[model samples]
Target: MAQSIAIVSPAVTIDNTLGALFVGFTVACCVYGILLSQIYTYLTHYPMDRSIYKLIVLLILTLETVDQALIGQIYYHYGISNFSNPLTLIEGAQTWSFILQQTLGSVVGAIVKIAFALRVWRFSQRNFWITGLIMILTLGGLSLALVFTIKSFMLPDVFSVVKLRVLGTISLGVGVLTDIITASSLCYFLNKLRTGYRQSDSLVSTLIKYAINTGALTSVVSITTVILYNIMPNNLIFIGVFFILSKLYAISFMATLNTRRVVRGKGTDRQNTTANHTNIFHLGTRVPSMGPSDMAGWETAYTATSATQQEFDQQRPIIPLNTTGFQDPTLGKRPAM
Candidate 1:
């Protein structure tokens, strides 16, 4: 009777690692909810943004949902149910979920990279070459991932991902480069757009810092995955790292989109007006809430509402942000070289 009910102990290490992975996944899902909350805050905080930006939010939500679903399925079958039948683990490893996660994760990462590249283009007033380089890298990384998907499943009854090392290496390499270029381009353009006025310079600096922080996150995770894969090709550690990389990418981008108020709060160095009216920041013109353009005599009491509505609107159009967090299309652009 005892022999009939025996459990395998050899699978314990892998099982524990998978348990850790699921814990990470739960935390990741919570972080994703935080991203959704930011989106909700953005909607309530401002007037309607452009339709395209809203569409992008919806697309990200859908992709992340599907991404989580794919992995969740594998976790349920191979990780949870197979605990009682360790032999089933070998047979259950790496199926369509394995293939689709890589593909979908790459797709999500590419969308974010391309979105940041477009931001650089906007800041540069359409710097064709710089933006073009970023876009090319984005496409290159994405194409390699697609090739990996094809090659991975193309073999005769074999789905050994380790066999596609070259493709995987290049794909991750290009992705890191893409993120670095995107972050650097935005900071460079923002630096050049500095108005020589102290108040505006403070705002631009805040933007540069935010760009660097968000940009570092996804790139660092990708680099870690690459290093792990090279050092442990036979192990599942790399798979665990790759599993959460997509969530990091999505969270970073979504936070950036909805961070106007957070960024604006940093710009207010002196005493602030009430929160409800304090967050408005017009990229090119003087903040209506902050004070008059003449910061030389800047005073908190000079609230925007105290001015005539038509006059305030004409100065900067009270236009809410369009998704990419572009403060003002005309306000912040590099002077032509």
Candidate 2:
């Protein structure tokens, strides 16, 4: 009797499922990115500076497209004998894309958190101590992400075998910590703005909801990737899971950024309307109580009188007052007497 062992090829139908998911996610991100770009253009045409933030988000979406394309290629080429050989250019491309996807996700997450923190600082007038603390935390989180990215890629000989597992664990932990810090800061600002009630509440609620959703998605992806990597150990199923999770994460991030642009745009419009009203009042066209030049003259005269009184007191006896009290030539006082 002869016994035969079954050899498992590192490919499966799951690759196709992942490919379909990636394509769907890519299309969604592209559409959302286009909308964001159009919104950015509209806001910039109104001359709002916040358009710059939207532009940064557009760049992130572009990166997501690249990441998805690479993953799609990997999935499409799966199990092809010519490309399945380990260390071949195709395999290298797949590995590099996965690494890049992870790195870009981490960077974009940190950037979005930083943007929120900055917006809070700008709008809420939070104390320097609070702002400083948030800044330190944001920077610390970013630095940790960068360190993991460098370590994961730089020591491939030592890391490639278990790097995904290690990096995934680290990424999950850091992502959680960053999310918590950001959420707490957001809550603090929201609480501070409680008196503003409706507008502030709505803005904060939207921000928190999206931030939490994105954070939760990222955590799930990171944790799932880690578990799959450990369990399958270089199996194609793990790769499929990784790609699917990455696409989901990218789509979620793009959505949040797009929502933020809309919120910021509305805020700018309100500000412009308020500024216009203020301009009308200042120009004396709205209130009509005082012309601009009259107000200016009155202020100047008041200021001159106060200064003269102060100077006379300072130089007590040095200045003399005439008994005639600087005669008004138009009304001669001596003739009347």
Candidate 3:
């Protein structure tokens, strides 16, 4: 007797698999558009930015573009080209693009984290302890991510990829740690920079808020991705969240850079208004009565004061407040004779 083979249609589980991917891809594209605008704003408005900074922005833009293209290929392979093949969709075959995207995502995450680490280092006055810890965690996460990608590539299907859950979890967990540390360090250092002037402190507070917001956003998304990956290793639900992870990193980094303009503008405005009412040479300093023979000493003191003010301004990363003209409120009104 000849046996008849029955055809099994694609399961509804695709809602969490392909459906999740489609939604994530859509959101990622939207974020990518925002990133493009940010890049344009950064380039057009801040042409004087350091070359290294420009290179970093360009590099992230290129990587994100390639990542999106690879994601498109994955969609095409599974959703379009293989539309008729229910078995492939159900099996969750990991294509080359899928694997490459995971690896590239790790690279983008590491780059962003390390860039933040550099910022922390600068804000912390090159504190090796804090910066070193962040760098180590970032590198560790990247290493684990690479390992996970390699193992996933070696596996035949998404189901097999589940076997590396511990590895993936650890990698993402490290990323979470890095994000928290980097943000906390930034806030701590920035708070220390508060000079007690209302405008200056407000700027510092804004910076701290930005650090918390960016770090929290990236960390939350990472946590969600890892949880989804572990809970449903067989579905592409986790991969869907992973799809937008790199884009978020890029957006956060660019947004932070672009904010410098807002800060600079506000600081300049505060500086100009304060300048109109205050003596440009007497701010944050007191002058001693000098004799004609002491003219050389006065000149030396003025030069030294200018150098110190310049150094202090340089220490501040986001808002370079020229403290020369801004009066510190703590110093009460000069006594009238």
Candidate 4:
């Protein structure tokens, strides 16, 4: 009994230490996500952003709160009081902590995925076909997530559940696929939307960068979790990555939201140019027929408007010229002097 207890306890301790380390990392990331969300809220006013956008962000933040709480509870159970007990390793899989984590995380994933799909829809100018297809893929992933959560509760233990394979594999696989599609679609359209100008194209490029970072981060995280689950089915190493996926997505969305002001600021600077109604065209890798700086000079020279034209006329002095047939009075009167 002493030998068995010694071997088992050490192994359990190792697992718990890793579990704590991962959950600690997850908590730190959650704090960062919340901070990002708050920054987004502060910058975007209610009227400036539609009610739906605000509400979705609210939902994601709320879910993140609950998810973080669940992880904390499980972390306490494994790391603090039960690290030395091997029996407690699988104990978490059957608890409410596990269930809520699965459910809430899945819901948050769906929310963010749909939000991105809506963005795609808007970018496409309400094109039903494109939006519909993306939404379909997102919904499919969400459905699989729902099934995985439901089945998790029905299962006996983490070991038994993971052995089923199809449930966990499909849910995560579909999620990765959805993220790839969403990110790629955004990049493709954002590239198309680039105006080849400094300001707007810079904004679009920023958006593409965000899309790539978030999408790749989540996709790689998901794949890692899936691989760990497959290889170390009995170990809870994958739990750490699995737990943070939703928060990553939420933070990504908030980061995207926060940058809207930056994009709008760049775009707002352009309103003056548009309102002026000048015709300096910009093209990719091609010189304009008239440069923007030159356009102002051209406009002053041939502006049909009375206001800008009159100002130029007043700025010039009326110089008197001497002709060959007639001399100026001031020059002719010099002889009498």
| Ten residues in sequence with the least summed lDDT for candidate 1 | 297-306
Candidate number of the best TM-score? 3
What does candidate 1's lDDT look like per residue over 1-337, in tens digits?
1122224333234534455457656766676677678667656653344456667777887887898888777667665776675445433445677688789999988887887787787667688999999999999999999998888775432125667877899999999998898889888977876665666577788888878987898889889989977876654567777877887887777776666545655554333343222333322122332343434322232221223432544596444556676556777688899
What stretches of model 4 exceed 4 Å from their correct place? 1-13, 16-48, 81-85, 91-93, 272-337
Q: How many backbone clashes does every candidate have?
A: 0, 0, 0, 0
Model number with the top lDDT: 3
lDDT (10s digit) by residue, model 4, range 58-137: 77777887888787776776556765764555444566786778778888888888888877765555668877877887
Clash pairs detected, candidate 3: none
- Which candidate do you rate higher for lDDT, 2 or 3? 3
Candidate 2, RMSD to the unseen true structure: 15.7
Evaluated at residue 46, the lDDT of candidate 2 is 27
| C-alpha lDDT values of all predictions | 0.68, 0.48, 0.74, 0.65
Q: Cα miss at 142, model 1 (Å)?
A: 0.8
- In angstroms, the error of model 3 at 187 is 0.8
Q: In model 3, which runs have C-alpha deviations exceeding 4 angstroms? A: 1-12, 268-337
Better of 3 and 4 by TM-score: 3
* Per-residue accuracy of model 2 over 261-303 as CA lDDT, tens digit each: 3544322222223221111111001111123343332222211
Instruction: List TM-scores for all candidates, in order.
Output: 0.73, 0.53, 0.77, 0.71
Candidate 3 local lDDT, 172-291, one digit each (tens): 999999999999998897787666566656767777888899999989999998898887776678888888889889889888777764654333232223222111122111222223
Ranking by TM-score: 3, 1, 4, 2
Candidate 4 Cα lDDT to native:
0.65
TM-score of 1: 0.73
Q: How many backbone clashes does candidate 1 have?
A: 0
